[model samples]
Every structure is written in structure tokens, then in C-alpha cells.
Target: MKDIILRLNKLFESRIRLGIMSILVVNDWVDFKYLKETLDLTDGNLASHLHSLEKNNYIHVRKGFIGRKPNTSFSVTDVGRKEFKLHLNALERLIKNI
Candidate 1:
């Protein structure tokens, strides 16, 4: 229905963003290098998508050091989980209606 379509979050419209969230949803924390490798994205491309999610408060970031190297990781927030669920439900509803 129209209401279900309207419930979908535009923030997840991008495939890259959707992929990022999908990984984060299952894992408690995912490192930048691992995500880049898994998603097959360049540094700039991944960073931009991450920035969008972070700006929306859908994901949280942690920066630290792994021995002598700097490490960055990401995790989904509670709000992000809720919104992602709603978006998925909207998609399901749309499919069922069709």
C-alpha cells in the first residue's frame, strides 16, 4: 500500500549503503579493511557511504590502534536496527501486494 511504500527509508536506497547495513546488522562490529574487502569497494567509495550512515546516526564508529596501526570499525545503532527493519517490512509488504 501507499503507506508501506512511504515507510521505506530513503537512506537505504543506495545498494552500497544497504550492503553496509546488512553486514553490520549481523555483526556486532566490523573493521574497515574487512568491510572494504568483503564489499569490494575502494577506500573513497566505502568512506562516502560510511559517512552518510554516520551522519544519519544509523551507524556508530570507533577508532583505535591495532598495535602500531590505526583501526576503524563500525556498528549498527538501535535506531538503525529499527529503521532497517521497517524498511525491510515495507519491501515485503510491497511485494505481497504486487
Candidate 2:
């Protein structure tokens, strides 16, 4: 229905963003390098998508040093988890209706 379609969050419309959420939903925390490798994204590309999610408060970031190198990790917020679930449910409903 129209209401169901409306429930699909535009923030997750991007395959990249959707993939990010999928990974984060399962893992406690994911590092930038691991995400980039898994998603096959360039540094700039992943950074851009991450920035968008961070701006929306759907994901949180932690930056620290591992010995001498800088390490950055990401995790989904509670809000993000709820919204992603709603979006997935909307997609399921759409598929069933179709």
C-alpha cells in the first residue's frame, strides 16, 4: 500500500547505505578498512556514505589509535536499528504484494 511504501526510509534507498546497515546490524562494530574491503568501495566513496549516515544519527563512529595507526570503527544506533527494521519490513510487504 501507499502507507507501506512510505515506510521505506529514503536513507537506506542506496545500496551502499543498505549494505552498511546490513553489516552493522549483525556486527557489534566494524572498522573502516574492513567495511571498505567488504563493500569494495574507495576511501572517499565509503567516507561520503558514512558521513551521510552519521549526519542522520543512524550510525556512530569511534576514532582511536591502535599502536601507531589511527583506527576508526562504526556501529548502528538504536534509532538506526529501528528504522532499518521498518524499512526492511516495508520491502518485504512490497514484495509480498507484488
Candidate 3:
């Protein structure tokens, strides 16, 4: 149990981050507005969390323009996918142990 707990990724400890990763893992590309609406997070709040993940190289951010409007999208990287899977496995182990 202790070993399994240690396998949990600290980056995913926050619900906000976990939610972000969850959405990114399944989607190819997700726009800022879509994530904000789905997660119901304020701009600043979401930005801060997104920044954290980006800094860690867990996600990739793309900035572009769509019909004269600036668009920002996110996707999970290979490293992120592997790490998140390990974290989820740890969580599953912990639950089953309990």
C-alpha cells in the first residue's frame, strides 16, 4: 500500500490538474474555451493550472488564430500519458487494498 501510494504522481494531486489531464488524455486537442466550460473554471484559475502542467512538460500548448480570434489548445504528451496511467493504477491499487 505504501509503495502504491508513493507511485501516485504528485502533479495529479490537485483536482483541477487531474481533471485537466483526464480531459486531455482522451481528446486529441481541446480548446481553452471548451475546457473552461467543461471544467467550469475561471480564466485565471485555469490558466494557472495549465501553466503548471506546461512547465512540467506534461502537456503541449498550441496558440493559433481561428477567424481572427486567438485560439489556445492543449494536449497530453507521451510522458504525461504514461505518468497519468501510473498514477491511476496507483489509485486503483489503493482503493482495492482498502
lDDT string for model 2 (1-98, tens) is 88888999999999999999999999999999999999999999999999999999999999988999999999999999999999999999999998
Clashing pairs in 3: none
Q: For candidate 1, lDDT tens digit of each residue in 1-98? A: 77887898999889999999999999999999999999999999999999999999999999999999999999999999999999999988989998
Could you estimate the TM-score for every candidate? 0.96, 0.97, 0.97
TM-score-based ranking: 2, 3, 1
RMSD of each: 0.8, 0.6, 0.6
Instruction: Provide the clashing-pair count of each candidate structure.
Output: 0, 0, 0
- What TM-score number comes out for model 1? 0.96
Candidate 3: tens digits of C-alpha lDDT, residues 8-87: 99999999999999999999999999999999999999999999999999999999999999999999999999999999
- Alpha-carbon runs more than 4 Å astray in model 2: none
Q: 1 or 3, which is superior by TM-score?
A: 3
lDDT (Cα atoms) of all candidates against the true structure: 0.95, 0.96, 0.96
Model 2 scores a TM of: 0.97
Clashing pairs in 1: none
**Span of 10 residues, lowest total lDDT, candidate 3:** 1-10
